[model samples]
Structures are given as C-alpha cells and as structure tokens.
Target: MNALYNCISKYYPITSEAWKALSNALTQIKIPRNSFLVKEGTVCNNLYFLERGCLRGYYSLDGKEITYWFGFEDNFVTSFYSFISRKPAVENIQALEDSTLWSISYEALHLLFDAHHDLERLVRIINEQYYIRLEERFMAMQFKTAKERYEQLIENSPHILHRISLGQTASYLGISQETLSRIRSQV
Candidate 1:
C-alpha cells in the first residue's frame, strides 16, 4: 500500500483521517496473468489500483482485440464508462502479468466522496487526468501516423516494452506485429 500512498500523496496531500478511511476501504487482491478485471458487457463495480505488474484495456472489433491503454504499477485501472454510468462495459481490462491490486467498490468510493471533501477532490483530479489522457490518445489515433504513434508511445512508456507481450504492444499501437517489427528494426 506504500505505492498507493506515494502515488496519491504525490498528487495531493490527505489528512491522516482521510488516509485511514481510504485504507480501510481498500481491499488487496492478487490477480493472475491472463485474467480479466472487467469483461465486455459486464458492469465494472470496482476501481483498482495496480500495486504491481501490468494491465491492458482493450475491446474486440470484428473479433479482433484492439488495445486502448495500459495500466502499470501504482496506477489506476478501470472500465470508466461502465464504472461511472453503471452500464455494461464496452472495453475489457486484463492482467498482463500476475498482479497485486488494491480495489474499492463503487459504493465504498461514493461513501468516501460524500464523507470527505479531500477524497472528492482526489477523485475529481483523477477523473480529469484520465480524461485528458483519453483525449490525447484519441487525437493521436486520428491524426498521427502509425510510426509516429509507436514512437510517441515508446517515448512516453519505455518500460512498457519490457512488461507486455509483443502482440499486445502491437495491438496498442494499432498495428500488425509485422509492422511493429519493421518499425522496431528501423528504430
């Protein structure tokens, strides 16, 4: 939980009371590789913070899986639309490696938000940051070349290369593994 503490503290300080409340709400669990955190068409009822390993968010298109984002250690991962709207998820999140995660149920989170202004602020900030990232990714997908997208992802998330499979990485880049190999060779 040190990772969670450090990450949240880096963003904003919380009172000891707030910290205790959050920790009390967090449940630690281990997820094995190849497991789904949230599957398409299911409602996402929990928000998880990865304490170790990697998770990928993807959705199937015409039976092909296309990855949209990855969550690394100390970062949050969730099917946002499903979690926020209480609707079925359009995306799926899976563990890329065996992982330790801290999770809070939707009810628990709302309770915290209602009880603590600091917690509410934290949630707001997290939401804003996630939205910004989503917009950036959407823009890149619409405007950037495949090679450019690959380069930008490598620049921003160098460690991801070592954490995920080549096929998964290619999927995230929206390219064929062969194309990723060609791009990698050129680099």
Candidate 2:
C-alpha cells in the first residue's frame, strides 16, 4: 500500500486519517497475465490502481486485438466509457504481466469522494491527466505516418517493443506487423 500512498501523495498528501478511512475500502486484486481486468460489453465496476504490474487497453476488430495504450506500475487503469457512464465497455483492459493492484468499486469511490473533498479533487486531476494523454495519442495518430509512429514509440518506450509481442506492438502503433518489422529493422 506504500505505492498507493505515494501515488496519491504526488497529487496531494493523504492524511493518516484519510489513509485509514480509505484502507479498508481498497481491495487487493491479483491479475494474471494475458487476461482481462475489464472485458468488452461489461461495465467496469472497479477503478484499478496498479501497484505492481503492466496492463494494456485494446479494442478488438475483425478478430484482432488493436491495442491503443499501455499502463505500468503506479498508474490507474480503467475503461473510462464504462466507468463514467455505467455502460458496457467497447475496450478491453488486460494485464500484460502478472500484477497485484488496489481497486475500489465506482460506488465506493463515489462515497469516498462525497465524504472527502481532497479525494474528489485528486480524481478530477487524474482524469485530466488521462485526457491529456489521450489527446497526445490522438494527435500522434492523426499527424504521423506509421513509420513515424513506430519511431516515436521506440523513442518513448524502447522496452515496450521488447516486452510485448510483435502483433501487439504493431497494433498499438496502428501498423501491420510487417510494417513494424520494417521500421524495427531500420532502427
């Protein structure tokens, strides 16, 4: 739970009292590699904050997984659409590695937010951060070529190419695996 406290502390210091109040509300979740945290068509019930692990969010189309983003330790993971709207998700959130996370259901989070002003602000700030990240990805996809995107990916997270499968990496870059291979060879 140190990670939880530290992560929250970055945005705002959590008092001992606040921590005590939240501790019992958080549930520990163990996610296995290659399985889902949130599946398509299911409403996301929990807001997961990864303590130790990596995860990817993807959409499936024509029987293929098209990953758009990845998240690592000390990061929050969820399907925003499903979470905010209480509707079924169109994306899938899956662990890339075996991970342990701390999670609270939306209902529990709302209750806490209502009770704690700081927590409400923290969630809003975190939401804004996610929105900025999404905007960056969208702009990259809109303006960059496949090779350029692959280059940017390599520049950003060189290990990502090594850690995930070729298909998965290609999908995340919005390119075919063959194109990914070509870009990779040049690098």
How much lDDT does each candidate structure score? Answer: 0.92, 0.88
Q: Estimate each model's TM-score.
A: 0.97, 0.95
Candidate 1, number of clashes: 0
Cα error, candidate 1, residue 76 (Å): 0.8
Q: Ten consecutive residues with minimal summed lDDT in candidate 2?
A: 12-21
lDDT of 2 by residue, 111-159 (tens): 9888877788888988999999899999999999988888888888887
The best candidate in terms of lDDT:
1
Runs off by more than 4 Å, candidate 2: none
Q: In model 1, which runs have C-alpha deviations exceeding 4 angstroms?
A: none
lDDT of 1: 0.92
Angstrom error at residue 147, model 1: 1.3
RMSD per model, one decimal: 1.0, 1.2
lDDT for residue 50 in candidate 1, whole number 0-100: 95
Worst 10 residues of 1 by lDDT: 8-17
Q: How close is candidate 2 to the true structure, as a TM-score?
A: 0.95
